[model samples]
Target: SQELEQSPQSLIVQEGKNLTINCTSSKTLYGLYWYKQKYGEGLIFLMMLQKGGEEKSHEKITAKLDEKKQQSSLHITASQPSHAGIYLCGADMSPNDMRFGAGTRLTVKP
Candidate 1:
């Protein structure tokens, strides 16, 4: 089984600043998914990467997969209070094996 690890377990940024979160996997990733969730709320799917060196962006958030397919980065531009939440990176190591990082908690100061 594979496991995902996220860096900077937590972050606090002043409003309008930019931040980046990294996710690394112990095994090759077949598929990588990013999700965001607020306290006590359900996870909200943000992006998915299937190919090596692939990237995707939605609004002010961007996600990228490294060429090795074992690492991913999520960049947030112009951080806002609305962006405060826990970000999770999930990976499918095999058809039946899936794992998720502990999640990175972000806080935006006004």
Candidate 2:
């Protein structure tokens, strides 16, 4: 699916493993937003970028925006069990639009 579908709806890895999740869209993304949320908890703001081909990262996670803006990727390095959570990438259909994928549920084993 090109409508912002993420792979491995869920992932399980060891405490210090590395992982990557992808987001694909049918059309170019004018705006991209990534959010991290713990189960039953609120989503903590991660990053948002408007310029195509732009990328931003925080802590152990990195997010990139494609020049075509049709795809994006999020990679986590040296994952810690505490890093387990849901990662969601969204595209703006309108200034107020925020469509999200089902999400990539990450589980880091201790």
Candidate 3:
């Protein structure tokens, strides 16, 4: 089993600004998934990575897996208030095993 550590446990950014959140793994990562959760809402699947150096983007948000497969980063461009939420990183250790980080709370100021 591997442990996931999400940096900046919380963040505050002005609207239209850019920000980044990082996730580190205690062991080599085989599969990684990024999710966002709004206040009092379920998690929304953002992106998934299975190969090293893989990158994915949706609208203003982008996610990437490092070449070493031990880290991943999520970047939000021209962030907005709508981006305020808790960002979670999950690692798929096996078919039946998955672990998640404590989650990063984002606050986008107007």
Candidate 4:
């Protein structure tokens, strides 16, 4: 079975600082999905990457998939308190099998 690993299980940053979270897969990834979860709430869809070397951005957040398709990173620029939450990375191993990372908890201090 393949697994997803996320680094820096937790993070704390000052407002306006930049931070990045990484996710690595035990096997090649077919597709990757990024999500944000607020405390006591369900996960919120962020973005998805399917191609190697692909990158996407929305507002201050950016996501990139490595050319090897085994890793992905989520970057947040100019952090804000509103950005505090848990970030999760999910890998689509197959149509019937999806794997998720442990998740990175982010705390943005004002």
Candidate 1: global Cα-lDDT? 0.94
lDDT of 4 by residue, 1-110 (tens): 32999988999999999999999986888899999999788999999999999999999999999999999999999999999999999999777789999999999889
lDDT of each: 0.94, 0.84, 0.92, 0.94
**Ten-residue region with minimum lDDT total, candidate 3:** 1-10
Model 1 steric clash pairs: none
Worst 10 residues of 4 by lDDT: 1-10
How well is each residue in 1-110 modelled by candidate 2, as lDDT tens digits?
A: 44678777999999888898988888767788888898678898788878888888898888888888877888899999888899888788567776777789999999
Give the Å error, residue 45, model 3.
Answer: 0.4
- True-structure lDDT of candidate 4: 0.94
TM-score of each: 0.95, 0.90, 0.94, 0.96
lDDT of candidate 2 vs native?
0.84
Residue 41 error, candidate 4, Å: 2.4
Q: RMSD per prediction, one decimal?
A: 1.5, 1.6, 1.6, 1.4
Clashing residue pairs in candidate 4 are: none
Off by over 4 Å in 4: none
Query: Going through the candidates in order, what is the number of backbone clashes in each?
Result: 0, 0, 0, 0
